[model samples]
Target chain A: MRVLITSGGTTERIDDVRGISNFATGSLGKITAEQFLQAGHEVFLLASETAILPEAAENLTIIHITTTDSLVKNMEKLVPEVDAVVHTMAVSDYQPVFMTALSNFSDDFSKDDLLHFSAEKVRKISSNSDFQLMLLKKTPKVISYIKKWNPQVQLFGFKLLAGVSEQELVDVAQKSLVKNQADFIIANDLENITKTQHEALLISFDRIVKMHTKLEIAQSILEKAQEAYHG
Target chain B: MRVLITSGGTTERIDDVRGISNFATGSLGKITAEQFLQAGHEVFLLASETAILPEAAENLTIIHITTTDSLVKNMEKLVPEVDAVVHTMAVSDYQPVFMTALSNFSDDFSKDDLLHFSAEKVRKISSNSDFQLMLLKKTPKVISYIKKWNPQVQLFGFKLLAGVSEQELVDVAQKSLVKNQADFIIANDLENITKTQHEALLISFDRIVKMHTKLEIAQSILEKAQEAYHG
Candidate 1:
């Protein structure tokens, strides 16, 4: 099977130099891609530039992406040719809301006057001793576009929740599966992620499968992909 | 000299699960700490947990910190004991303004009704399909507290400006030196940072010395510390 896997976290640029990003190591996706290749599958890995990966392999191809838009563009271009997708990338859901700079002078510049700029612009202003207000805008839902681009390709999504109970974790994962029309959703809590031993649940429409260790989860995901392809 | 150095970027929590952080790798700080140790100085490295570091040394002690508040707390405890401070950490200047969730929303909820909540509240709202506003509040300036905490320590601050000309970079660095009562300020442009080679200006009250590589900059900073300690 030809598979497309995205790993790591996407960054949203606040300026030419700085950006907002998450702490995803892309280890999960990298391991999963390696597992798929060891199982005799061709892999295209769309990974964040900062994500760490093992040494190169013959059956694997890697494309480094930095931002959410770039990830979308690559996915749109590559999804049609792949047989399945395992998207483990944490895409930013909000972009800095752009706002115009306000120019004025006075000890009493109203808070109302400062609300004109974005949190990003306010950060720039704060460096110069000027306190300003900032705003944010929501980014488009990237997962919802997958089926639009490739309806037949089997899709597996990842949902990470922090400080949530197991029931809440499963509930959210199930909602995500239905919303994205995904074949399976991998659910994990952040608290468990910090421990040496970790567990995750693979939620499909009819049942939930629990797996221990990231390597075991990756193997289970591959097995499900094979079933998806040959079923 | 007993030297204290800070490296990497601080993170500000946006919610229970997410945060705002910069792209600081702490490479510069790690290298500088190693250089200090090589110069026979006892070093205290206050670094972000995400920052990379070199192999362990007997003369070095590493304190891992995450947020600006944690950085401040560490500095307050260690500043008076150190002979010099090389603060290279990219401390976040803003934290996400958290908001309470609004309940009892209907399908016909008007946009005006949502405006009653804060921008932080709006960001939470936007996640569920009701687009709303976001606001940011400025974080306390961490550098400004250095002199207040320890008056006699020879302090070196770092200033990183993106897409700025040499004159602008120097001006900002010089201003930072005056504002913080810093002994010296190392200024660098972000555009030059991505290149194979990098350059920085050491701006003090009396003179500006330009250095060509990170290693050279680290060496120069150490020399300044030695001079301040002995002079």
Candidate 2:
């Protein structure tokens, strides 16, 4: 299977020293890539700059990209060839609305009175004809773009929720399946487990399966992939 | 304040090669210990056998011990002086109905000839009328045991669940709080966000707050500890 996975958070540079980054370690993305490779699937990872080292797998290809705009560019180039895509990266919802010339950029936040920057970097990236920017514009849903290119490719999307109950999670997951036009949705309780380690649950259409370890969860994903491929 | 925190899973030997262990990394407990120390509260950690190193903090007093019985012994010796206790360890719910000594044990597994071995190592350690191994016995809740010893000392307990919905979790948390007599409960959703770096929900008395980073969660826990101590 030709599988493409995205890991880590894309950095939307605010300045030379600082940028917007979602606090993510890319653990899930790395594990998914490892498992997919082990199962003899061709895997390509769209990774972001982070502390985690990508696992060295014989059949896996890693691409390091910094911004969501670049990620989308790479995805447009790769999505047509892949049979399945796992959208796991926590892409920043917005970048600075404008970009400064690299030569004139300042590392210190105090010296920001020079350039009168309009919020174009923020508005232009979010100004898709279909989506709107209310308080915060939604980053273009990568899955929708992928579907536009290759409608038959299997796509899995994730939903993380807090302060909501389990029934709501399943409801949200089901709703996301339709809203996002995804083949399957993994509804994660962002509040329960952390990257450290713990048991996990996989909620799918037929049933919910319990996985005790990270490896176990990855293996389950592999098995599900097999079912998807063979079915 | 002097605080005693127990964490990780206690492994009970099933035989020479196999055993039972709850999948706990002691991450939550260690983080709690780290939080306590950061808030100027003195902490003593009774950790289980895991390769991960305990984080160093100036206010922490690290104590390593194995087995539930040993942990109980340590608690008996130290609980008198501590200001609060957090029972976060995934202590074994059952010891081998009989513990076998290595010198007298034999490992021969033949499905046709099932043999049950009775050994002296399984003898009851303490004489308490309440400590009967009634068939299908539920593990004694640790917080209640600590409460019996020190009614004035604040105690927190942890509960882990898989595939439980959010509304169910709240009800379960409240019931556990009353049943365990815990001043507060750290209820974790084991199935969701198992390997993800960010995403977690903090369920308190009146609100379920969403936390997206380890640092934020750790800080929130520390703040809670400070509130508990100062109030």
Candidate 3:
């Protein structure tokens, strides 16, 4: 089987020098990719440039990406060719609508005054700390596009919820599974994910499988993918 | 001499699960702290927990901090005891005003509807991809408080600019010096800092000293601190 895995957090550029990104280390995704390759699957790792990855392997190919847009573009090109995709990238949902120079305004300026300034005026900001305003815009849902691009590919989506109960986590994961038409969704909460060992729930239409540790989760995902492929 | 150094980028929490932060590896600050310890200065490292640090030394003490408020609190306690302070932490200038669950809103909602929703209402969001809005509020400048807390400590502030000319970098550094009453400001642009070897301009009231490489920058800073203490 050929597997496409995405790890790390997507970064949205606010300006030439700065960006908005999440705190995904890509550790789990990298682990998953390596596990699949160890199981004799060819792997294409679409990863954030900041993510720490394993050393090169004969069956592994790495594609480094920076932003959500770039990730989408690469997925469009790669998903069709792969047998399965495990998308664990912490894609940013919002981006700065406009970036203003921190040096353009004084400390005393009101929010109204700041909001009134157009993106055109904000682009001229030159100084680092000129007191600026950045309005955030919602990014399109990338996972929702995966099945659209490749209906035959086995898709495993991820749902990360902070401070949520197990029931809530499963509910959210189910919604994602239905909405994205994913074969399964891996759901976990913040409290467990931050610990050395974590647990995740794998939800498909027929059953929910709970697995402890990242390794177990990855293995279970592969098992399900194999079942789907051989069935 | 007693040296107080701050490293890593401060993180501002958006909700129970997410945060906004800058891309500071704390490599430079960690190197500077190591250099100071090697030079026999008693060191207090108030650093972000995310930063990588040198191994423990008898002359060094580490205090982990996360947010700007935490950093400020630690500074208040440690600044008076140190002879010099090197503030290299990339403190966030803004924090999200509201954090709502992503499950509450539908995908079809308009931007105007989200904008009109009060923070109180938006706080009720539940799902992960429910399309949400986050408002950003300016954070108080932490550097401006250094002199007010300790009048005698030699303060070294850092100014990082991206895609700026050398002249612009120096101007921002000078402004920081005057405004914050810093003894010196180390100025560097993104283009140079991203390279294997980088240059920084040390801007003081009397002179501007240019140094190459992270080690040279750290050494120049300590040298200036020695001049301020003994001269």
Best by TM-score: 1
* Per-model TM-score versus the true fold: 0.83, 0.43, 0.81
Q: What are the runs in model 3 whose C-alpha is more than 4 Å off?
A: A49-58, A99-117, A121-133, A162-171, A191-197, B49-63, B99-118, B121-134, B162-171
Backbone steric clashes in candidate 2, count = 10
Candidate 2: which stretches are off by over 4 Å? Answer: A98-137, A196-201, A205-207, A210-213, B1-231
Candidate lDDT values, in order: 0.78, 0.61, 0.79
Off by over 4 Å in 1: A99-132, A162-175, B99-126, B130-132, B163-168
lDDT of 2 by residue, A126-220 (tens): 11122111111235556668788788778877665554677887887777777767777766655555666534456666676666655776677
1 versus 3: better TM-score goes to: 1
Please give, for residues B1-231, the per-residue lDDT of candidate 2 as tens digits: 888889876655433222334556677677777777776789889887551335787777777765577788788777777878877787755444432222232233221111233434421122212111111112344556787777767766765555567777677777767776767666665555444453455565666666665455666656665677779
Worst 10 residues of 2 chain B by lDDT: B128-137
* Docking outcome class, model 2: incorrect
Query: lDDT per residue, candidate 3, B69-106, as tens digits?
Result: 89989999999888999999888876665644334345
